[model samples]
Target: RLQRDQELTGVDVVVLDECHERHLDADTTAAFLWDVRQALRPELRLVAASATTDAEGWSRLLGGAPVVEAPGVSYPV
Candidate 1:
């Protein structure tokens, strides 16, 4: 959508799940979203989420965005 210069109408948030996997497509999408947020939509909310992701690194990459953690649930194996 971004490459075509189409506006992200009605889209308030974007969550990149499993960011720790570091796949090329995911990385590229994140990069593009970051660019969009920076250049076009400063109000756009972007979230990079993963249970084992580097929170600090992602936060820094997202221009000092805050890191929010959800409590984990324990389950017997």
Candidate 2:
């Protein structure tokens, strides 16, 4: 949406799921979001949701943003 519209205006947040895979598209999206947040919208909230994402790496990428890890709970099916 950012590239197509040139800007993501009025949006509150963007949540990226399955970021632990670290695919090209995910990385690109993260980079774009980062750039947009830096240059355009400082208030835009970006959340990288994943089971195995490198919190430290992503936090650093996001200008030392805080990384909050949720407690993992599982139940057998």
Worst 10 residues of 1 by lDDT: 1-10
Question: What does each candidate score in C-alpha RMSD?
Answer: 1.7, 1.7
**What's the distance in Å from true for residue 23, model 1?**
1.2
Report the C-alpha displacement of residue 41, candidate 1, in angstroms: 0.6
The per-model lDDT (C-alpha) reads 0.88, 0.83
Write the residue-wise lDDT of candidate 2 on 1-77 in tens digits. Answer: 77776468778889988878867988888889888888888888888777787889877877887988889788899
Candidate 1, 1-77: lDDT as tens digits: 76676347778999999999988899899988988888888999999899998999999999999999998898999
State how far residue 46 of model 2 sits from its true place (Å): 0.9
Q: Which stretches of candidate 2 lie over 4 Å from their true place?
A: 75-77
Task: Look at candidate 2 and tell me the lDDT of residue 25.
Answer: 88
Error of 1 at 56 (Å): 0.3
